[model samples]
Target: MYITMEPGSELAWELYAGIDEAGRGPIVGPLIIAGVVISGKCMNKLSTLGVKDSKQLTKAQREKLIDVIYESARYIIIAEIPPHLIDAYNINMLEEDTIAYLVSRIVAVNSHLKLKEISIDAVGSSKQLAQKIREVVPKSVRVVIEEKADRKYVAVSAASIVAKVWRDRRIDALKTIYGNFGSGYPTDPNTRRWIHDMYSLDPYNPPPIIRRTWGTLKTLAPLWYKKKRQTVAGREKTQKTLADFLPKI
Candidate 1:
């Protein structure tokens, strides 16, 4: 990759990368993380496309821009975290680790690209998240973590669009099998109603797509919450019994 630095500039950034996520708060779909890298020269084209934060755009508008983003990006990386993983782990840590994974992967695969900076839309403490990323990325690379970075950086905004588009398609595919759940947000009445109805039929076992650990389930169906607790206790007891049988080392 051709690399250049402005005269007397300390930063010789040749390619800019941005990272953003979608479906972080949704109760139904997978969390989508996307990272986009574009040469400094191509960034003007991205800005000209009129891309903004994905939340500010309509579905049709995002769909229209997805291809353009793909065309303009030097590299686009995406990852999907399933609902079960979200339920089993701390979401904030999961996001942080995933961001590090994406950044490391991008750098490893495109070692030739003179990538210098990465801007991420913050999910938790910006300082902590940057620390996690810095541990894996090259010392020369600069990590920028900011609240609402998607709104401020065109690169982050493009990443947000890519992640959002992927998540929307995944949700649509799920709806074909599970029926419309209306955004899979706890605050969405349609989503709550669907959960209520599903739990009414089978309180002990939620649909595989839904997050079993969500507080919304406990509120809508106490029976489901009770059963989940009981199941967890059973697993713990079984593990203890197995430990007892094992010879102490």
Candidate 2:
């Protein structure tokens, strides 16, 4: 059941929530947004259970904690924006829209839940982004958007774990379909190699999964390299060839 609350000023409830995402920087896989809601009783317990930040935890630990978070979370929800959609839209706008949607959906789905506040790890380190999130949500849900919110808030940390786990599962699925691409970042040599192979095999048409808009593709791919080569060839010709009717003095 979905419930929409009247937009109100900043509110305070005992229940707290944390928001975070994973796959934000990856060149492969969908970006994930996750939020977990916890009341006063479980917030402290979550911290004690070693919930810090997803990046700080091992894969096994994150898997183990997903169950724990589920057991304790009053409401948990995630939204994923796939690579194609990501390419279609502005990333920052997509992030803000997705975050606003996730938080609002959680609160709306559990209309009975009396959440006091939510803290999010800012996407690009801006308070205005937080304010943008808050403005879309029910005004009663006070938002504390800031940098490192996942590290600062146990709830955000738990959410981060869920997000990372979700991203990993998707990455695993993608590997099954497309073979392996290492860590799916530009820094990974294996990833770069896969891209190079793709670019060579299909210079003008790499797989849709590849973010063609990304600089990595345009800079490293053969299409741009071939164009550069042709440009240099033209320049070299212009330099060497003199006019046929040049006057001999």
What would the TM-scores of all predictions be?
0.84, 0.79
lDDT of 1 by residue, 55-117 (tens): 999999999998888777778888788887666556776687677777777677556668878
**Candidate 2 residue runs with Cα over 4 Å from true position:** 1-13, 125-127, 222-249
The stretch of ten residues in a row with the least summed lDDT in candidate 1 is 1-10
Clash numbers, per candidate: 0, 1
User: Distance (Å) between predicted and true CA of 200, model 1?
Assistant: 1.7
Query: What is the Cα-based lDDT of residue 205 in candidate 2?
Result: 69
Residue-level lDDT tens digits of model 2 in 38-104: 7777888888898889999999999998888878777777777677656655566567756766776
Best by TM-score: 1
Error of 2 at 214 (Å): 1.2
Candidate 2 has a TM-score of 0.79
